[model samples]
Target: MKMLLTVEIPHEPFNSLVRGGKAGEIIGRILEAIKPEAVYFTEQDGMRCGVFLINVENPSDVPAFAEPFFLNFQANCKFRIVMSQEDLQKAGLEELGKKWA
Candidate 1:
């Protein structure tokens, strides 16, 4: 099944994890290593955050991926996982249509 993992992280944790020009590098390495189908980042209420959509061979990978980030990011960070199809419906995402862009 495919899963969409949304992570809310503090700006300091993000800054501490990587340096200038290195966020992309870290994300690239993570994608290459973990092989998530898609990854996205955004700012919310002026806070740094991200979402990762991945196709997994088994259900267990969900917690596996989440744990590391939780441990590393720690302070005030939160993680949420949604099965792609179900979440889109619940959030009325389909109704947004092309406006998602």
Candidate 2:
């Protein structure tokens, strides 16, 4: 199974998580551990944001990984995990990720 992980947030979220800070380092490690097929983010106003997908072997395992993020940020975010097809033609995976990205 292949997974596409999407982390959507306001523009500043990128800075808080990836701009050479301690939090950034922690996030980098988390991303590496997850080994998401891809990573993408988007801008939302007033700090509200959305994360699209985080593919994993067991779809149910998302919360285990997600809880840390929520705790770290003290923010509200939504997550969704969907089983994907091995064949791209049938899965339409590329098109799906771009819809939100």
Model 2 per-residue lDDT tens digits across residues 10-100: 4454556656566667667666766665565455565534343555567687776566566555545555545545454677768888997
Q: lDDT tens digits, residues 6-85, model 1?
A: 66777766686676556566656556766767778887667767777766667676666666566555524343454656
Summing lDDT over every window of 10 consecutive residues in candidate 2, give the lowest-scoring window. Answer: 1-10
- Model 2 regions more than 4 Å off: 1-20, 48-53, 81-101
The numbered model that scores best in TM-score is 1
lDDT of each: 0.64, 0.57
Candidate 1 wrong stretches, greater than 4 Å: 20-22, 75-101
Instruction: List the lowest-lDDT window of 10 residues for candidate 1.
Output: 73-82
